[model samples]
Target: MDQVTKIANRLADVGGVVAVCLGGSRARGTHTPDSDFDLGLYYRPPLDTSALRVLAAELTGGAVEVTEPGGWGAWVDGGGWLTVDGARIDWIYRDLDRVYRIWQQCKAGLFEVGTQAGHPLGVYSHSYAGEVAMGRILADPTNELAALQEQIQASYPQPLRDSLVAHARWEVPFTLSLARKGVTRGDAFYIAGCLFRVAGLLAHALHAQAGCWVLNEKGAVQAAGQLPTAPANFSARAHALFGALGATPDELATAINDADQLAADVLDNLSPG
Candidate 1:
């Protein structure tokens, strides 16, 4: 464990590397025995991943999963994955300029949600801000990470929260409306999709209210189920919403209404600390 931290500290010496930190479950101290080590490298524009790739190769002494800087497309364009001494380590690249801009926009009452490949549920721009602010700094020789944490950590701006809340409030009903329409058309697939989308939106809203930054939609349900405001037996409810074998139209409508009301109540009473 110390060696991994030591290696991460060394990565900060690379050019354009502003900070290197530990993130994800490990940083949050929520890691299980099998959880992967998430090493985040904060860099400004003109990032060079060669140093990372070379280091990974040196550590593994074999082929490693790495991409040339900017090769992986948006959201994550650099970094690599390595297994050092049987410990799984994932390197994630963060553009400090982009994260800073997103955090600034969040403070200015601006936020946007969109979906990307491999992230079917969705993503929010403000998520990056939270990660940067909440991450555990491992190497910050120039004090860049310290400065960023000062501006971003645990800072829940009202605009960002309100934006997400409003978005969820609208989306829940919008999808429910479509689901109702699907019943009329006997389109089970449409209803299923609507349910999935509404679940994700509700989960997103809950995370926002909890002052949690969500990077993807994959774990939204389980995470939301743990929130204080979330309904009891959320996993069961999710199953009922998504798992209905030849369910009648009326049953589907009931589920939709239940979700709608649950989402509304949660949004209305939200108070992020």
Candidate 2:
């Protein structure tokens, strides 16, 4: 069986695990084979502090770190956090009641979870909420995306609308998927960079639509939507990265392929079934 299935089975075997859900890029159908399995395991009541620590050690080979769940409210670096077969496996612990509520919201296409990664990390609504809502609006393909595209285009000055669509198509899916699974990979820094660009673009549109100011890479203030703020010094960094991305598209493709291969290798070794 696949590594994903293996993780799922292992999680199920654990006492108190109430439900297991596979999320992230794979579940979203946008994963490029290199993506890792983001397995979220909901346990009855909730794992105690000691249990959380033990699980983390077991998963990370004594290197699995633990971070207390603060504002976002989901325990991170808890047990079940490990790197297996070059793919990161994050075992997020959520109370069964909360998990059921999240599942209900997910099914209703709410796309908002209370806290991700078993921490107080709530879902960034502005990020994926628009995408999910837009997906529904454009479900008919009756010029729905186009209509929104036009509205955004006319409302925004230049490049912002096009950029948002581009990101909404490519970048946002990856971000939302990662956020969904509570697993993130920084092997390619560009993932974060791409998201930075998306935020800038969204801010631009939101500013035009709602009339607000957004901080940009250069700190040159611009009218952007009330979207999330861009990274402080991202603009200067993006130039080189874009050039690198263009030059190494194949390398990026290979990297993703390598991740998938690694996940496969681990799965082969573990043999879920």
Candidate 3:
């Protein structure tokens, strides 16, 4: 068996582990030769972290620490990092019940972005559903994960799409207004932060309009640029705006104006999905 398959089997054998799946760029078939494996481990409550830690150590031939549930955060849950056979593997834990609940929320057009360390733009609650929709099952003895994945892949919820687009559309201008204030004071740092938020929000709106699930902020703008609903030169303009940001009041003001124009273009181009 391949290394990933072997790893997934081992993970599935761990007590409380309901399913194991491949995630990230690898699962999406967009991975480069160097992309590390992102493995999702869906488990019930009272997970056997001790077993997981032992298994990780065995796989790596060294001591490894597995975080307890909620160790990473509420949304991210917990897991461990390991290098098996010289290949990096990330174990991301998901509470099965929580995943179901979150998926239901997405179907109902209700989602929230929560603070998470690794996710600079915050973790979207629908990301759990996205993960399942995008993941490739490696081991699912009970067929629960497969069934859930099928349900998620069947269709992109219209309510979820509308909710995401509406929220992002509202935030883009609100965030830009904050950046405008910073431009007058030549607060490049603050202005830059707000601009990044604007870009991210615009990406979110575009992805929603395209009925795509945005897993995170990484490459989100570029991904949105690929969508038919995206504004012309959306990613290029966003990149240029960021590249042109300057510390001077006049330069910052110009960047703000460009960003506002980009936002208007995106809003104008958006159509009902």
Candidate 4:
């Protein structure tokens, strides 16, 4: 159908490729005109790393920038837009069996119900489950928001669902601000990671409210009180981290506003103090 899919199929036809999976906003159907296709190339065991690298380099028409491995397998950025008969294409490659399972699962399920059966999905990722969990916590049968939360609540829970209300309301805004700053400063990886992290937080915040969980100002405040203190020396590093993310004051305000609304809505559904 699409050029990316065609290329993937072609690549799969190559001898060593075990499977070719798609990912990113494009795969999720949230792509804009400029979004590039993100593909994960999983090869059978005993892959010739050099050979694969050579093929990718040749295919991409630009140098490959490899992300440091996070234990399983390395992630490589395939630069250059591949033009097949005048159509532009850009993509990334992850070593087979080395990708994050949650990403794979979500990508697989994008087109159909049973698409993600054997792969890992964001089911266990706190970022993915955060908002949904929060919505569940604030269940109110009469409210429209409550109904929406109820719709997705059965699917999954945040990694730390009970603790999300407090953390998400504060941390998400902070992290979002930090992430934008990182993006501005060219800390793309940090920005991407923080964005995903905040998404999970928002998900939890929404779920807690919809589920009518123990989510109230008192509970939230208590959760805030329980936050682990950062060491004094780390304060500077923390600020630098924020700086790296290019966290802006305005962006922080927006995050805070969104988090607050989600929090207030959940609070409204509460059955009094």
Candidate with top TM-score is 3
- Could you give candidate 1's per-residue lDDT for residues 155-256 as a string of tens digits? 778777777777887777877887888775667777778888888887777877776777666567888889887777765676567666246777767777
> Between candidates 1 and 2, which one is better according to TM-score?
1
Q: How much lDDT does each candidate structure score?
A: 0.76, 0.40, 0.89, 0.41
What is candidate 4's lDDT per residue for 150-206, written digit by digit as tens?
Answer: 543454333334344555557766775665565335555666466545544443354
Tell me the lDDT of candidate 2.
0.40
Error of 4 at 255 (Å): 10
Using all chains and alpha carbons, the TM-scores for the candidates as numbered come to 0.89, 0.36, 0.97, 0.39
Which candidate number maximizes lDDT? 3
For candidate 4, give the lDDT: 0.41
Among residues 3 or more apart in sequence or in different chains, the pairs in candidate 1 whose N, CA or C atoms overlap within 3 Å are: none
Q: Which stretches of candidate 2 lie over 4 Å from their true place?
A: 48-60, 67-80, 101-273
Please report how far candidate 4 places residue 190 from its true position, in Å. 17
RMSD after CA superposition, every candidate: 2.5, 18.5, 1.3, 15.3
| Ranking of candidates on lDDT, top first | 3, 1, 4, 2
Clashes of each: 0, 18, 0, 46
